[model samples]
Target chain A: MQAIYEYLFGAASFVPHGYCLAWRPDLIAIHALSDGVIAVSYFSIPIALILLLNKREDLAFKRTFGLFALFIFACGVTHLTGMIMLWEPYYGAQGMIKLMTALISVITAISLWPMLPKVLALPGPSQLRAMNERLADEISDKNEAQIQLHNAYSQMEAQVVARTRELQEVNQRLKEDVQRRTLLEEELREKAELLTATNAELERFAYVASHDLQEPLRKIQAFSDLLKREYENDLPEEALQYVLIMQNAAHRMNKQTKDILTLSRLSWDSIKFASVDLAEVVEEVEFDLAERIEESGGKLEIGDLPLVPGDRTQIRLLMQNLLVNAFKYRAADSTPEVKVNATLHERGAPGTGGAYVELTIQDNGIGFNQEDAERIFSIFQRLHGRSEFDGTGIGLAICKKIVENHNGAIEAVSSRGEGAIFKIQLPTSQPTRRNNDAGRNEAI
Target chain B: MQGVTKRFKVLMVDDDPEDGVLVQKAIASAGHKVDFQVVTNGAEVLDYLFTEGRFTDQSRAPRPNLILLDLNMPGVDGFTVLKQIKSNMDLRRIPVVVLTTSEAETDIVKSYDIGANTFITKPTSFADMIEVMKSLKKYWFDSAQLPVA
Candidate 1:
């Protein structure tokens, strides 16, 4: 133990290394000064490595760099020992530092070999610059696309209105014919098909709306279109006029069939009750009518509405009908504005009735006589000549049926010039829902 | 149109001859030179597509790029025809457009559920019909998407 201690720390019994240059002052000074400069420079390299490691905690080879710093610092101390050995010859400590530096250098070298691929994999500056450029280009392209879409939509809207007006006014004589006297024998036809589709008790109307009568009318319109396209220049003017009338009448009848089909489908299918959000329903209706509203230059104001237990589809139809009627009957000079507002009212008779929602749809348009309010909802009832406004006249009637399906009541009041107001009251929840059987699937 | 070399083939299944003529005229006026063929009933359509029963002659029954279907027919209805065509591996790629007078939502939903590519209500006016069919021309000319073998 004594010998080992001596081997590691003893500095006695040895001459100073200054003897190598024969104690020349100039040579001694040069060796000490050179060692001093080399030690300081070595120490500075490790300090710089340590500073770099501190700044870049995310560096891939952090431990290896730390090991390099330790070894480089050991090298600096070894060089300092070299400067000191000139006088004191601390050979044992010098040997110890050199041995530690060798161990650290070997470990750092081993660590670096394994990390070569990882260090190389790090993204270079030019690659990072390209990625940044690509990301910036994508953002700008997406922004440009959105702007172009917005522009195209408004342009298309303008084109649609202009083209439709031109099509309706294609023939001066046809325009006069469209305005002629009144609707066809719609009342008589309605007495049969109208009651058939709405009255679930009537089975024959279901067959009629789905087949036979509609097919012939559809064919007539199709062939008339074909004739007009093929023989517009060849046919006599009178023949072409007859063809136009046939096309017009057939088209109106087909629309009536569609309305009847809608009613019949309601009668055929069972209503599915759900948590119907009236505000959302009104928003959807507004979206569907957005184009029409734009063409009419109209506005719709919707208010907060309570959720009711009813069919969402039926509610949508009811709102659509009223809103369409409002737009269709707008005063030629005025911009139409329709407002939908609702309130949740307290239950009636306490235990006897559940809560109900009362809704009011009001419009600014050409209104009808108060006396005809009741008649307007009847099937096939039209308040104006087809010339003034073209409609199947079944819109209000469908609205009435939808209201009825929800176990509700709908009524309208209007003066000749004052716009109409439709008041609706429906139970907040269906009473039959408590049985749970209705909630479960059952065919109508 | 720049690279096209042959006329696009469209097969229409309709019972009404007038409707057939109307669609043919509409396609012709759209400036898409079409090899328009019409079959009057559902049975003929099945035969025309599968080359079975009356259309055994392969040369007479060339595969169409598109099919225009009408739901109402005398024998096997359009729904059956659509189901058969969509289920067959050989015929499933041809796009089917349901051209019908039925505005019933059930028909629309059922046609889509059965794999009809498009559903359109039969138009009432020549101008509107042209407008309705403009997209059909667009679809026909989209050669990259065409399943033509």
Candidate 2:
């Protein structure tokens, strides 16, 4: 049975049914190879399209390019499988046909390898055009947004300009207001100065007028008193007593007027500075008041005094007045020990740069009440009666003025019937002090 | 007046004309024949001395031997005038006595500093003024040497 079948099929089964189908095996092999080639080509085209679509990322291209190359080689394998299957059967009978089929299939598959990458380079034209249109729309939208922002910037610029103009106007108004205020202040200051000057002039005129008036009044009082003294019996006693009272009042007025004139003169003259020796001045004062000092039994001890810069004669007057007061009001039976001492007090104060020479005149005299200490320096202020202590009542006031003229201060510390210490602090060579040095001895 | 050095010429510089008249009377009362030249203020004193303004007749307005300077004169007080006269080399030779109402010690010292021959407080009593005038005659004419022009 096997022999009969072999004769009828003419070795078709043994050689391969694919070979019998071909009058030429090469043609048959060509046909079989074409099937695998077409399939692999179609498959490779899809793979290349996927690779191209995913080629944007560097990592995607690295992974996908290798797969694409492998796909091409896989296509080559389909043709290789057909050629190998036909090779074993036709190795002796039709070797050229097998070899030729394999060679042609391989050449076609290999040729498709590079062409697949070129065919799938980018997307189709319609899809790319659609993407470009979408991108153009997005850019146009951005441009519209920029135009809106530019309009907003212009509006903000207008607002800023308006704000700047408002601020400038405000500044101008403020400057004008300041100028007006300054002018007003200047006018006010000038008016104040004029008022002060006018007041001073009026006071001076009044003083002079009253002082001159007193001279004529004095002659009247003197003549009237002379008439009363000369013709006492010729006039009534009541009339004589009235005339005496009138004379006394006139004398009091004269004294008051003289004191006022003296005070006015002191204020009118400006103070000046010069080298003044207090020791010499005190010695002269002692000589002048020798009788009073001797009669009162007051011991005047003037110690070493520093020479300072001041009005010399004024300081002399100051010393004279203070000494007179001490002698005039001595403690009963106390021997009236008046010690005049001066020492440069080294305060070493900040900003004062050292010492202040203070002339202290302390006296064991019949001191006044504590209340009178401050009041005694005032003009026409007296603690005692004219009968008890004869004075113009302006002595201490004049003393204060003289001391003040020397840029010095006089203060009295006293207790009733105990004693009194008058401290006179005068600034030394203020010329040597720096600009900022307000004298330490300026404290009154 | 005959025995005394040929009736001394006197110049009184005062702000008040009435005061000037009073000074003239006072100078005349001493029995000395004093040709007293009166100027209203310190300005007139300068005008008379320097022969400026109204006082152009230099020879007619003879230079006075004594100047009785009242300190409170207007338009240039006696102090200012005194300072100018005492400092001037041409005029400093003349003796100046400061006659003013102020008895301030400072004024007294200042007058001496500015070359004033003497500083005398104005006495309220005319009798005291006469005494001052007598002393002035004794000191300037009898005691001190009088400068001859």
Candidate 3:
């Protein structure tokens, strides 16, 4: 232990560089400053490497950086020894430090020789910069994608708002339409009720008026007749003439009132529709007008008549009126001839389908002017004065009303000094709804 | 008024006095020995028939062989009177003829439905009325057999 200690501490064994040369302070200071500066630089470099290694934990080739740090520390220690030798002549210490330095340099050199390829393979600063640029571009692309996704979400939200508004508008319009339809239906119902009430009132008025009017007219006729019969011998010639006129007027008025009542009764009266044989109606008319026909010496000719849908009583009345008119208007020279015939008329275009029965009552009598043919159907319308024709002028009007009630039409063709033809068209089937309403209004 | 042989009694029901008078004159002119009694309205006719109210005395209110009913009356119409008379077993035997100014088919139909014996419109002229009365007398008094009073 004494010998080892003597060998390690023996500081006078070697000469110092400063003892062999002139003691130049400036050179020594310069050398010492350089050694100190080199030592400090080496020491600082190793500390920086340690800190860099700690911070860059993910850096590759970590062991290589550790080896480099050790080598730099050894170099810093050798420089520190050189700075000490510059002050004191410690040649043994210097030689020892140099020997350690040489040993560390050899280890470092050998270690570096094997790691040359690894060091070359390691990415350079420029390559790392290029990779970092790519990483930054990827990050930017991801950010752009996130922004676009946000924009799409916002646009979708806006579209949803617009769609919601449109749906709300459609729903509003549907609600309005429903309200309008309900209102219109209610209005139509109210109008229909009002029309029905009016029709009923009018019917009642017609019935009462016609019924009450007959009573007074009957009394007038009765009392006038009583006056004429009770005062026949007491009255003078002129007074008797006046009485005759009064009687004639009263009789005409009574006939007119009766005719008016019959017309008014047609409005409220309900008639049963049945299959009426025209031949039967004609036979009844002939029987009813037998007296008139015999007085006029008229010959009645009957032909084949079809069965038609109509009211039996109305048709009988219709035939009676036409036949009576024929006998009443006979010529003074010729005997009256009345012919009744019926033919089937196809309605609408030829061969189309529906048919109606047409009854033609031709008369060889003193026919009126052709202009008066249509005018004869109007109530109380007469072409001749009461003196010329003895009638209430309501017979043809009644005939017209009866035909209309059966949903039929009556037309006359006549010329002065010539015969007259009364053509009546009757439906083969029951009247259609429109025709039925028209017939009802015509009754009113 | 003591009768030789009780003539055919007729109770004429009418609202108008003039019509009643005319009908009486017509029956008299027709030369029929009809014991015509005039009642002002349907109520009076009912009183005369059932011997009630003013006609409670049996002698004055004789059982009518025939009733001539007017349709349009103030208190009780002819249709109701006809229905009431026909429904009553005692009064239904008396033939009730409808004599009115109404020639409406409804009036005739309703009168017949209520058991009216016959329906006739009162003629406007006196001569026509006389003729109708003659026919009525011939058919009701001369031809028809009445129930025992």
- For this target, which candidate reaches the highest DockQ against the unseen true structure? 3
- What tens-digit string does per-residue lDDT give for candidate 3 at A1-444? 666545554555755555554558887777788889999999999899999999999977677677777778878888888887765666565677778778877877888888889889888899889988988898899889889989988999999899899889988998898889889889988887777666656656655775677678677777778877888888888887887787788778777767766665654566667788888889988887888888777799999988987788778888988888887786677899999999887784112246788889999888889889899999889877777778988889889888777667899999987889999888787632223322342222
TM-score of chain B of each: 0.93, 0.90, 0.94
**In model 3, which runs have C-alpha deviations exceeding 4 angstroms?**
A1-206, A330-335, A349-353, A364-373, A415-417, A431-444, B1-4
- Which residue pairs of candidate 1 clash? none
- What fraction of the true interface does each of the listed models get right, in terms of native contacts kept? 0.60, 0.00, 0.75
Candidate 3 lDDT for residue A155:
95
Better of 1 and 2 by TM-score: 1
DockQ for every prediction shown: 0.34, 0.17, 0.76
Q: For model 2 chain A, give the 10-residue run with minimal summed lDDT.
A: A432-441
lDDT of 2 by residue, A147-207 (tens): 8888889989999999999999999999999999999999999997787677567657656
lDDT of 1 by residue, A1-444 (tens): 888778866768777789777888898899899989999998999899999988988877777888888988888888888888898766787788889888888888888887888878877788878877887788788788878887787788878888887876786657676655234445656665665444545533654654557877777787787788788999999999999999889988888877877775665566767889898999999999999999988899998888987888888999999988888798888999999999888875123376788899999888889999899989789989999999988788889878777778888989987999998888776643221212233322
Best by lDDT: 1
DockQ winner between candidates 1 and 2: 1
State in Å the error of residue B84, model 1.
Answer: 2.4
Candidate 2 ranges beyond 4 A from true positions = A1-17, A20-42, A45-55, A61-64, A71-73, A76-268, A331-334, A348-354, A402-408, A431-444, B1-120, B140-149
Model 1: residues with Cα > 4 Å off, grouped in runs: A1-207, A235-239, A287-299, A330-337, A349-352, A364-366, A369-371, A431-444, B1-6
